[model samples]
Target: VGSRCGAAEFACRVNAAVELLDAGAPAAEAARMLADRFDCSQRQARRYVDRAAGGGRVVVAAEETVVFTVKLPAPLAIRVRERARESGGTLSALVTRALTEFLVRGQARPRLW
Candidate 1:
């Protein structure tokens, strides 16, 4: 738990950690990389990695969308799929919308700096 972050930023950080982990980096090493990249504490980095490993989804949204291989526990994956179905949207669309809302809200804030 670092300083409060919007969902898109947190998802981006988590995706980076997942990439490191998928590339065979040890958990501690991945956490260090995440901390360095995001300017966050090691504890915060570790929490992100742990969350992903425990079946959280990692979403990477790009201008030209690319496929990301995320491992989710069966139940959670099923739920997401179901939600997509209920909303009459693709999984990508659902995720994109959610992240977009999060980012938009964050950007809408008045920055002190």
Candidate 2:
């Protein structure tokens, strides 16, 4: 486990988080900005923001990913529907499974610090 923040670092990060929030930034974005500004990781920035914003987890992991909404190409939509029907699933289920697979494969491996 990592060491808990020293009082000074904790105070500094909290102050930075408050400044960004006061400027009307969303929690996650503000955290990212604060991290960049203060040369800390995004996770540390999030911790700071969480502490300042009532001392709880301010960001959910899944919320960091992309979400897409658009009409699929006509032929692709038809094909997807047919496949879903064959599998006794809805188009949404098929899309979700596909997206999950895509993400799992596409994600970069974690780097050592």
Badly placed stretches (over 4 Å) of model 2 are 1-5, 55-113
Cα displacement (Å) at residue 78, model 2: 60
Pairs with steric clashes in candidate 2: none
Q: How many residue pairs clash in all the candidates, one count each?
A: 0, 0
Reference-based lDDT, each prediction:
0.81, 0.73
User: How many times do residue backbones clash in model 2?
Assistant: 0
Cα lDDT tens digits, model 1, 1-113, are 44687668878887887788888999999999998899989999999898667644655445656676789899988998999888754688887787789999989998888
Best by lDDT: 1
- Residue 23 CA error for candidate 2 (Å)? 1.4
Candidate 2, RMSD to the unseen true structure: 16.2
> Mind giving the per-residue lDDT tens digits that candidate 2 earns over 26-99?
99998889878877788978878977776422222333334578887999989989998887644655798898
Model 1 clash number: 0
- Per-model TM-score versus the true fold: 0.50, 0.42
